[model samples]
Target: MTRRHTTRSSVPRTAVRVLLGAAMTWAGISHLTVAREEFRAQVPEFVPLDPDVTVLASGVAEISLGAALVLLVRRQATVGWVAAVFFTAIFPGNIAQWMHHRDGFGLDTDTKRFVRLLFQPVLIAVALWATNALRSRR
Candidate 1:
């Protein structure tokens, strides 16, 4: 008989994961509704799709990922990696926002936008850390 050994996340990690998931879900919903125009401002001019379409698609993706993060405890590592990648993928849009001086989400000043750019990596790291993605499987 084979015994299954399941590792449990620490309390802090679980809390962080839930918070991140909730935040992402809220942001995604905003992307589709109240903050649609603000989100569109983040889409880089170089992206081929129309800004609204990109916003909508990304909103859907965020919602799915957020749900996965919260509900898929066993698959948390995978979700974490995906979330990290998503954050990385959208980083260029943040840069574009800074470069183009597009105002959105209270990032009215260039310094504010530039400072916001620094948070993407933090979010990526948090996602990975919260889900044990940074840990090695034994």
Candidate 2:
């Protein structure tokens, strides 16, 4: 069996990747289980589907993206790009939460919810950085 090479330069990137991957996994689980209702609270009322189904689908996507980040080193850039897009796609949910003044999972106040919405961009940056997608091309 062949082992994947670990470059010294990638240590920090790898750590961030692991954190992103774990976050996705945790969010995925929350969507499916303990925090499912909380996730539903984030669903934009404009979206037509039953909130449960949307939550389930998003949960599955999170798990898949999370697994890809953790397992597909060779495809990290692609995973990262997808991760970025995934976070972008979900931004509306954050917006909805803020607009509706919904509360859940430690974001029990309008200020907390608004502040939480700001973190989506940070997550995107972390994804890109973790995959080195933002590094200068050789």
Candidate 3:
């Protein structure tokens, strides 16, 4: 017997896509300006790149991913994969920050630092799932 396929709706998918896209876009902008210094402080010493360059590159990458997420939301499966991959790509920076345990960037404490690290993966999963939902309908 063949299983039935369900048609996907675009309304919910568009809503989620817009939200994640706008949020990440804003986050990328913040990293480039308002939070640049804070991000600079999070760079790991062993990353083998200049702090300024790293921050700038990261901000650009973030903005690009955010744009992609927005544009590709309708292609849920593809966007899910892309977002998941992007999230994994940035894991190192989080690990570096947690391991280094430095202060003065603007974080309240080491606990906050580590907590933020833990949240990255979760955000990725959400992005992936939201995108996937959008894709399923198409």
Candidate 4:
């Protein structure tokens, strides 16, 4: 009989991953509900889709990705990579929000919006690290 060995992430990584997932899920719900208008501020004018539609679609995406992160323990690395890519893909919206000085989610000031931009990379890194995507398997 052949046995398969599975690797588990450290406690801190697991905690972070779960927390990130929960946060994403909550944000997704907000996008579809109370924070719909706030989320619209993040959609760039150049985007082909309407701002509301974009926000809704991204919300669905976030919900799915967030669920995957929490449920797909065996595929954490893959989920992490996907989450990182999603963060990268949405980065332009952050830039647009900052440049246009859109007021949403308490990011009224340019400094606040610009400062918020700095956190995207950190989220990407956290997703990767929490999923063990940044580690090499021996």
**Top candidate when judged by TM-score against the true structure:** 1
> Alpha-carbon error at 119 in model 3, in Å?
1.0
1-138 per-residue lDDT for model 4 (tens digits)? 989654564878889999999999899989899999999999999999989999999999999989988999989999999999999999999999999999999999999999999999999999999988978442
**TM-score ranking of the models:** 1, 4, 2, 3
Tens-place lDDT per residue, model 2, 1-138, is: 998888997999998898889889888988999989889988999889998999999999999999889999888988999999999999999999889888877888899998998899999999998998777333
How displaced is residue 50 in candidate 1, in Å?
0.5
Of candidate 1, the 10-residue stretch with the lowest lDDT total is 4-13
**Tens-digit lDDT track for model 3 on 5-79?**
544745665577678877878878888898887887777787789988888888887788788778864465676
Q: How far is 95's C-alpha from truth in model 2 (Å)? A: 0.6
Model 4 residue 83 lDDT score: 98
* Stronger candidate by lDDT (1 vs 4): 1
Tell me how far the alpha carbon of residue 112 in candidate 4 is from the true structure, in angstroms, after superposition: 0.4
Q: What is the lDDT of residue 125 in candidate 4?
A: 96
Please identify which of the two predictions, 2 or 3, would achieve the higher TM-score against the true structure.
2
lDDT value, candidate 1, whole model: 0.94
Runs with alpha carbons beyond 4 Å of true place in candidate 3: 1-13, 104-106, 133-138
Q: What is the TM-score of each candidate against the true structure?
A: 0.93, 0.91, 0.77, 0.92
Which parts of model 2 have CA positions greater than 4 angstroms off? 1-7, 136-138
* Error in Å for residue 37 of model 1: 0.4
Q: Which model is ahead, 2 or 4, in terms of lDDT?
A: 4
Each model's lDDT comes to 0.94, 0.90, 0.74, 0.93
lDDT of 4 at 36: 99
Worst 10 residues of 4 by lDDT: 4-13
Model 2 is weakest, by summed lDDT over 10 consecutive residues, at 129-138
Query: How would you encode candidate 1's per-residue C-alpha lDDT over 1-138 as one tens digit per residue?
Result: 989654555878989999999999999999899999999889999999999999999999999999998999989999999999999999999999999999999999999999999999999999999999989443
Model 4 backbone overlap count: 0
